[model samples]
Target: MQIDVLIDVKTTLGEGPLWDVQEQRLYWIDSVDGRVFRATADGSEIRAWQVPQKIGSMALRKNGGAIVALARGVHFLDLNTGDVELINDPEPNLKNNRLNDGKVDASGRFLFGSMDTLEDGPNGALYRLDADLTVHKLQDGIVVSNGPCWSPDGKTFYFSDTWSGEIWAYDYDVEMGSISNRRVFAVLQGENFRSSDGSTVDEEGGLWNAQVYEGKLVRYAPDGTIDRAIPMPVKNVTSVMFGGENLDTLFVTSMARPPLSRFPTDSVQGGSVFKITGLGVRGLPEHRFAG
Candidate 1:
C-alpha cells in the first residue's frame, strides 16, 4: 500500500509516534529539538511541550497521565496540568547514559531502553516499569537500544539493538515480567538498512519494524519471514503506530539525521508523519499512568 505524507513538522530528530484514543490525539517527540508534540487525527491543532532535555518516548499512563522517558530518568507528566515530575532514574552512576526508545506493554507496564550518550560506550540497558512505579532492569550491554514489543498473545517479546542491526525474539512471562530463550528473529542485510528502530506488533503477531536509514517499514512474520514492505517517501523512517477510528491508519514518524545530508534541501518528506490507510490490524490500547 502507498503511504501518504500527512503532516510535515520538520523535526530535527522525530521518533515515538503514539496514538491516544481517549484524547483523540497523536503524540510524538523531536529528540534533538527537546520538544513533545500533539496533533489531531488529521494533523490539525498542533501543540508542543518544551522539555528540559531529550525525550526518547512517551505513553499514556493507566492512572490518567503520561509517562515520558526524559534524559536519564523516567518522568510522570500531567496532560491536563502540564506538570512533569521525575519518577525514576536508573544508572545514575553512568552520567553519559540516557533513555532511548520504549513503549508500554499489553499488561500496562512501561518497557524502555537506555543508551550511552557517548557513542561506543557499553552502558545501554533495558528496563521494565511496573504499575506501582518500581523499575526492574531486564538486560544490559546494549548499544542504541530500540523496540520492546509484545506479541499478540503476550507470550513473546520482540526487541532490537539498533547498532547491531539485529532483531531478537524472547519468551516473555508476563505475570513475572521476565524474558528468556533469546534467539535471533531477523538479521537485516545491506549497508543502507542502518538499523531497526521503534516497532509494533499486529494482531497476527507479525512485527512491523521501522528501518531508520533504509526509508521503509517491514512486516515480519513470527516465524522470521518477511511478510510485506511499505516504502516511505523519506529516508529516515523512525517509528510507526496504527491509529484511526477503526485502527486502520498506520501513522509513521520520520527523521533527518546524519548520512542523509540531503535533509533540508533534497529531502522533501523528511521529518514528516505519513499515514497508510486500510492495511494494518487494530493495535492494542496504550497504557495510562496510574501512579
Candidate 2:
C-alpha cells in the first residue's frame, strides 16, 4: 500500500478520524486542543472549529452537525455556528474520569466509554446514548478506553482498554443496542507490544487498528489473527478510518506530544494526518448518530 501525509497540521494529541459517507468528507479531532477539523476526501477545503472542552471522539449526526464526546459530557456540536449543547453526563460524580473513544452503532445509537484521566485505576464505564436522548450504562471498571468498533455484520462489538493491553469482543444486539458475552479477542504481547488506539472494520470483517506507540497500522482477522502490519514513519500513530469516494483509502491520525506532561516527543511528522491507498480492501460506511 502507498502511504503519504494528507494534512500537516501539528496536533498535540490527534485522534478520532471520522469519514462521512453521504457528504464524502473527512473529519478528525485534536483531543487535547479541543478542535474539530473537516475537509473533503482529497484533503481540500479544510476547516476547523473550536469546541468548549477537550474532545474524546465524534460522530456525524443523521439530521445535521455532530455528536461529540467531550471531557465532561456528550454534546451536540453545531458545525455552522460552533455551538455546543450538553446532552448528559453519566458520571458527573466521577470527577477524575472522562469520555474517551466512541462509535455509532448499527441502529444509530452512540456507544462510548469513559477513562480514568490519571491512568491509575478502573474507574470508568461504557455508556450508550439512544435515539430518545437517554443514556444507559453498559460496562464498568475501565482504565483507559479506546477503539469502539463493530464487525461488518453488526453482531459483534470490539473495544479496547489501552492500559489493559487487550482488545475485547462482545455479542451485540443491533435492535436493542446492547452488548453481552464479552471475551478477549486479541492481546498485546511481545517486547514491542503496541497499545491499540482506534480501529475500523473492513467490508471483509478485518479490523484495522492504529498501534499508538509502535507506529504501525495492523489488521486483525475476524478470528483474531494478524493479517498484516504496516510500519509508519511517526512514532505516535493515534487513529484510523477509511474515507474516499469508494472508501478504499485508510486515513490515519497521529500525536505530536505525549498525553502526559512527563513525556517528551521528537518525531517531526508526529501530528500530521496520513492516508494509505492501494490496499485491495474497502470499508463499510460509518453509521450516523440517530439522535
List lDDT for all candidates, in order. Answer: 0.82, 0.91
Q: For candidate 1, what is the TM-score?
A: 0.93
**Which residue pairs does candidate 2 place in steric collision?**
none
Q: Residue by residue across 139-220, what tens digits does model 2's lDDT show?
A: 9988988899999999999999887878899999999988899999987653454478899999999999888877788899
For model 1, name the residue pairs that clash: 60-288, 61-288, 61-289, 62-288, 62-289, 63-289, 63-290
Off by over 4 Å in 2: 190-193, 261-264
Q: Count the backbone clashes (under 3 Å) in each candidate.
A: 7, 0
lDDT of 1 at 283: 70
RMSD to true structure for each model, in Å? 2.2, 1.2
